[model samples]
Target: MSTYIRQIKKNVWKWKNENGIFSVKKYPTVEQAEKIRLIHKELEYMEKPFILPIIESTQEDFIIQPWYKGDHTVSYRFKEDRKAVHLLLSQIHDTNKLVDWEDSNLFYSFNLISKWQNRKWKMNEISFFIESHIGWEQTKFLLLCGDIALRNMKPFNMEKRTLLHGDVVHHNFLSDSSDYKIIDFDLAVIGPREMENILWMHRVLPEINYDIRLLIHEFPHLEKVVRRYKEAMMYPNELYREWLYAYSLPKERKQKFIEQLIPYTNKALTEWPNLCYTLSKL
Candidate 1:
């Protein structure tokens, strides 16, 4: 039932089982694994019944997978990023406008849902996901892959139970000459838009460098694709702060992240003309 991939990459080990695609992740320790799982359970409660790749106690490590559709990855560029972004956003925006999340999620009561526990909030037991006190599960947990850097947008909606490319990132799409297919579903979940995904209209694509910076500058309207996803993000201010603190590592790591993020922000602000500072205080 299990097909193994030798020489697995960093944290995840991928394989094929009688069931489907699977992965194994080696956490630093059992405590780390438990912490992450607890956080994820809360995330599931917040969103739809998020069915992630399950965790298994293997002889050697923890195993999981995002439940892949079919195996595939490609290195070629799509014929057009602008066209893809526009087409995808237009379709999604029209769709989202029809659905109201507060009304939709009202059907699910809070008591039946899982809540964060196990950790004490007492003075002795406090730990943080960030220096500012975000919790790992609570921090920037997008209902969907809000990070447009990577994509395999086989669209699917959690509440509607319709699957399409959920993400519309440039690279998520691949065209073998004429046909196109999505490749990643790591962020898929089943719920309404707010809890299932932070679909936004002004999302930051993970493009770096002066060339992309220039492209974003010259074609400012193209940023609308990024904005389209930003529009649907549903994080409340408190949860947003909590999630950041939860996942924020030590000072060195935070420094590294800030280094990587500021430039992206600067570039985005340039083309966007009215970009909001999500992490300004941090």
Candidate 2:
């Protein structure tokens, strides 16, 4: 009956104070953020001294977390933790072990995620969800953030590895001078790291204004392996470059590039003999 509730129902809810926020995207197509917020609330119901942020309450139409109040952007940032990232990976792997797959994980899959809940379209699947209804390849491999790429690894872990944030990306990790806040676990499937989130950066970093030399110079440890993957395969220059994405190339060229990358895929199976058993099945 409240204005906030009405706006939220229409998928047009905004923060009570949307002063400096530039990009404001609501649930977008329909009422989904509300349902997501609700599920998080239920998961935290009857708990003492909530570990996560205030996710939901009958008092507010939607959940709102503290956001940054600034206009400055970093020109040169340095991350100083390698062990923390590996530790986060271990935590994610452990937590991810507990969850099964759901339909919402696929960005391209349709029918599997279609749902009409309480008279509105809602998405509740994890990033690993498959479009298929059943099976091992369809379900087991559908886990979000399972793909192996190093750029998705965050150099910091502030939530202390206790609370399950489910999704981890640079955007979700916030800091003021020396502290970091993990935000938006609403879409989380109770466990997993940044498979999709990391892929987003890995997929887009090249297209953005990122400095590749700087990226390699500072984040040398990870890029070493990525560059090696791109270089190891004895394929055409164009496709081999596209395969190990320490950066994102144009999608318009993806198909042609994939054609170029196939030989390397074959070569990868050849050179990485230990992985030959697994690659053969693919």
Compared with the true structure, all predictions reach lDDT values of 0.37, 0.33
lDDT of 2 by residue, 1-282 (tens): 222222433443444443322212344323355545543454344223122344334434445443354333221133332222333334433432333323233122111011112111111132122222223343232121122211232232322222244444445544345433334544544322323223322322322223334444544554543343331111122212233331245668655755545554344333333332322232
Q: Please write out the lDDT profile of model 1 over residues 168-220, one tens digit for every residue.
A: 44455444444334333333322333322233222323232213333346446
- Model 2, residue 155: distance off in Å is 27
Shift of residue 92 alpha carbon in model 1, Å: 9.9
Candidate 2 has a TM-score of 0.33
Off by over 4 Å in 1: 1-4, 7-11, 14-79, 82-171, 174-178, 190-200, 204-247, 250-253, 270-282
Q: Candidate 1, TM-score vs. the true structure?
A: 0.34
